[model samples]
Target chain A: MKRNKAVIAGIGQTEFSKNSGRSELQLSCEAIKLALDDAGLAPSDVDGFSTFTIDNNEDVDIIRSMGIETLRFSSRTPHGGGGSMATIAHGMAAVESGLCNTFVCLRAMNERSEARFGIAHMAPNSNNKGSGSGFLEWSMPFGAATPAAWTGIQAQRYMARYGLTNADFAPISVLQRKNAATNPLAWYYQKPITIEDHQSSRWIVEPVFRLLDCCQESDGGVALVITTEERARDLRQKPALIAHATQSIPFDTETVTNFYHKDLTVFDSGVQCAKEL
Target chain B: MTTNVKATIPANVPATMPRPQPLPGRDSAFFWDGAARGELMGQRCAACKLFRHPPRPMCPNCQSVEREEVRLSGRGTIHAFIHPVHPMIPMFDYPLTCVLVDLEEGIRIFSNLYECEKEDVRIGMPVEVFFVPTAGDKQVPVFRPARDAKAGSKGARS
Candidate 1:
């Protein structure tokens, strides 16, 4: 893991939307093509692929559709959004280890228009064998069905221990919306919220989370090109050097419905990951 | 809605959705069975003596396959609790409090907290487990504010 061994040459994404009116595979190909174009590389230049395990798009479909030449390496990391950064790490390792000359990392989703994870009735199917699936068995029977339901309890404990109220969280949402408002690509572009707005928002979980506190479900795709720093220097875009990339999964953690941990306030995995970094 | 109903649905809305069931595998059935029998069951490694929950086939510590079903003391303190209000489930009463409790046996359990006022629900508040009928006609462990516990005395356990 030598410093500056690998770098991100280009990044691209589809416009954020509630409905992309296209399949995830199409969105993935489009984003990847955009990334390749940005890097001044053709589809044939990509030799490796890295993405999330939960991503609906398949490597074979992408390779066939993009006409990529000589696919040599492919890997998918688990943990969905939590493992998102790991995709880049995988790509970096592929290129740095001399396994491949160029690698592409991607994530494409139809989160809103297709399947909604935030909906109460949309519990992860036990038969599907996916992340956070069986973990819901202990929870769903008790009416804790949604992600909000699973996360709300942990938020409550953290707030209570710190002597903080729900109002204390309003500023965070306000800041988030404020930042989004300034970004043209943001869903809430030009629409900043106030603390009063956050307070007035309907409660998703009483005394813990409001509607504003929750993340918006949207459909989109994003991809990145990773190659050796030496090769990246000649790319169209200025290369962003990768100093280090690592992922860690601590003991006693089960994805979002991680209720078994002794301490509800602390995310041991993040702490362990930071220590590794 | 009647005064005695645990959850409140909108007056005009029909409560049509069925609640999700555990569909427990062989390894985790003991826990659901213990709840049906008015007990909280946990798993302990027969070799290393370390306890695990949501039952697994093997112990991570010693890789021991031999394990025993241990009945845990239904006593614990509230580590965290939340009341869900949106995308309401018809089976559940509105303003329901779901709590994460740290058991006396050194494991945490996720169950709903009942018979407690919103203002009274706080972190480290002592609570005791009880069985409640939930979706799928399953008897699951829930919690209530412990009787005989002093109020305002935080039951913080590190």
Candidate 2:
């Protein structure tokens, strides 16, 4: 069957912050409404939804609250930020497959004030247990509790094998900050950092990084409305066409720490995704 | 009511209170113990004698359960490093330094290198362990440039 061809019709985001007064459900609804408005559509037009498992809101509750006409599809991806692009990938697939015409992809969290995902070792539960917990269990007892600590392992190894340094990572932060500065919706919007600033920042993990080199813990919501390309062209605003999308799991991949793998320096999953893109 | 009677309290306190748990299993116990002592430890197979971190009970190469705990020399070179611009979770405004160390024990350990100017942290610089304490009375072994080492050595490869 020919693919239906999907495109992003609208985008909406709440201000990023350490805390938001509203509940997670309220954040989800607000972003979804904004995206609908941007798309020149209504809650009644959305038939599908996709988000992450880490999100606290449920699909049924969201649909009921929004009064969506008919819920045709809904899904939750895993792996936190790694699933950012993957959520879009799934939405595009759902649209192209003719399973749903209007789909929404969203990430809503009060990472700082509510449930911080970056804490030193989260409790093991049904969703986070097994493979997820297994990977963490290996390091947490040894004091590698935080995500930075886990990534520090790979980051340090990468630095050792290559001729890279803390300065090299500064560029990455600078570029992202520059991009965020221009993006009014970004939490760090209007705030720019220099290499000197990055260097001067306090150390979070030694040799692997500094304070400015990390991402923020903001309480906000970001949403994208996806629909068929043919329909998107007829919409009020120009759509960012979905050129391609793919998700990947590298060989012998574990959640975050794949120490047992032959090569720990590179993120093979990301590399694979890049290749597909 | 004044009789000398022992009061029966609910025995649920032990169940409710959180207990100290080991991060690793029997196979990798040594790595955790070593970290508590501020030492970088890895597993070596009795057969092939290759070193591995996040220590496993069995050797990946030889599948030998007869493994030994080896103390790493803590001297290694940086393979790669990055300084994140955005604040990642639990690390607010914290700069990160990730390095791959080629241990003198013939094994490579990945850790954060610290205690110097972030600008001075070049790839291939010699580094040694600097243990940081944790909440559970355990210590984490981080790395930084060793004192009195040659300024710029070739970057270490995996």
Best by lDDT: 1
Task: Give the alpha carbon lDDT tens digit for every residue of B1-158 in model 1.
Answer: 32212422232333344434456678899998887688889999999999887789999889999999999878889877787777877766555678888887777888878777766787788888877654566677888877756655676533
- On TM-score, the candidate that comes out on top is 1
Per-residue lDDT tens digits for candidate 1, residues A1-277, read 4743989998888877898899999999999999999999999999999887667888999998999977899998887477778888899889999998889999888988986677865444642445544676777766676777777877777886788888999888889888878867667789899989889889888888888898778888899999999998788998998887888776878766777776768878788878877
What's the lDDT for residue B11 in model 2? Answer: 21
lDDT of 2 by residue, A1-277 (tens): 3457789999888877777888888888889999989999889999888887567778888888888888798887766577766889989999999999999998887888897655554343322452343565554323355667668767776776786777889999988888889978776789988999998988766766787877877899889999998888778778888988888876556676655466778789889989999
DockQ metric for all predictions: 0.63, 0.14
Work out the TM-score per prediction.
0.90, 0.68
RMSD of 1: 3.2
Error of 1 at A96 (Å): 0.7
After aligning candidate 1 to the native by TM-score, how far in Å is the CA of A30 from where it should be?
Answer: 1.1
Instruction: Give the Cα error of residue A188 in candidate 1, in Å.
Output: 1.9
